[model samples]
Target: MSRNQQIWLGELIRCWKALAPADDNTRKTLAGLVGFAWQPPVDQREPEATPAPEPELPPPVAPSAAPPQPMTQKPKEPPPNPQASELPRVAIEEEAQLQAAEWDSVEVLNPPQPHNRQYNNLLPPLFRPLWSRTIVTTLASRRLPIGFVDAERLVSTMAAARPVERIPRQPRWTTMKGVQLLLDKTPGMAPFLSDQAALAALFDDCVGGEALERLHFFDSPLRGVVIGGKKAAYRPPQPGVPVVAVTDLGLGAPESHFNRAAPGEWLSLVQLLAARDSTLTILLPWPAAAADPGLQRCTAIVEWDRSTSATLVRRLLERICG
Candidate 1:
């Protein structure tokens, strides 16, 4: 213990002894604690037996008129048993403190240890349950279907000689390509660990584990990273695949946190995806406007927070379909 702590303890033992206050539970507890620790009058252990008395030589007797009084001897007392005990006392033994306490002593207490803690979820649910397919459609690739006929085109294919063996449906946009999930794994995204897990489970249900591919990147996707113990140069999935990235775009970082993604870093990513004819959906904790306006124009940005709704995801699909 430090000198200051020992000094305070000495003062506490002294003042508490004088007060002998026990009006409340706090005071009573402190008294008990101090008594238990200092224990000025702790019980002393008792020995099993006293050593045997040595043999005494006969004493020289003086001749007297009356017969010498028979030698008188005192009886020996047995040693006290160690098993006999006394309960520890918190009250000071001084008569003055006892009299003062009877007149009513005041109580005091040090702060007790915290018994409870404030709890909070770093990430709340964004998408409602059973709406997995909605997210799938929002983040999946759409392509014009072949082997199907437009109603207008079929009406124009006039020879009338074509057998109606196969009824051709109208050509339309179909959500066909698998999804690529790029989740940020930097220290800044630590709070969203649970959020990532929920998102992963939802995507797994939509495309199944085999169809969904999840890649973890430290700060930016345009940098080299390791996956499954193999280091690889960063690359996006095949062309026409949708990439849904859950990132903060370094907007959530403090000024001192330099190891974060910048607008340029993400813009380079946007250019790469554009070249591949793939859409990019950024699930950010903040709004799309927080990022550079130019970057927002190229990437479909959706806030990855509780405020996100089914309508918002539909809008994302509309943006991608365009």
Candidate 2:
């Protein structure tokens, strides 16, 4: 190559070396220009090789110096499965087709709503017909008839002055006392919300709103209860008024419940109900087995269920009243 050509080529190669990526063509071109030999950088020429890990040596075993023995025959591998080709193959994936629902098979019923007249009540069928009369029988007080004429009083008035103390007339159990419903609004009584509503309706129907009263309490009334939306001591209606109290008597409470009523606490309440001028009847949700024995003796406990018939309530009330 000419001297000028060599100089230009040398300059171009140096420029390429500084700016361009590594290429064999540049080295070749530079070699032809002035016998230029390309020498790679020291780092590219020799690289530090990572040592391969040595294979774990077998545990030291004593070498046996036995004489050479005849070679044993090698066991052949098992033949390929003959039935593999004959097996039925299933599709790897199938395109699923959605079918229309068989809505005709199902009967869609538009049931009568709760507010509808066709709606059947949870109250016992036999109860509504018999409870008003049955309760009257249970709670009626023995008093002389209003228009009763006393012969002794008439004779006393005819003979002496002022009728010598009004003649005592034979008492008749005919007067129907008013009623009050004491409802337990505690956690234990939550399940009986519907039952309470049914009972309230039943009582309200039996005795008009004027005669029917509702009171609220927690687990027990020993600590008092809610009266007129304010905390007040729980007392039944006035003398001759019957009170029907719906309570679980702490039987529904958990074992570790803090407000669970003790047998003595229940006894005190029962004594108050049965002994006081206000008569109380418990509509217990639990079975008779868990009932307090003292409570059983004090007042009539009627299980609030389909099993509790009018006859059963009448018998239970008669047992307490008689």
Candidate 2 per-residue lDDT over residues 177-265, each given as its tens digit: 55777888877887777667766665665565677778888877777889878999876567666677788988787677787767787
Lowest lDDT 10-residue stretch of candidate 1:
36-45
Q: Give stretches of model 2 more than 4 Å off.
A: 1-175
Stretches of candidate 1 exceeding 4 Å from the true structure: 1-123, 130-133, 141-143, 146-148, 153-175
Query: For this target, which candidate reaches the highest lDDT against the unseen true structure?
Result: 1
Colliding pairs, model 1: none
Residues 234-282 of candidate 1: C-alpha lDDT, one tens digit per residue: 8888887888888888777667888887788888988898789787888
Query: How accurate locally, in lDDT, is each candidate?
Result: 0.64, 0.59
TM-scores, all models, native as reference: 0.53, 0.50
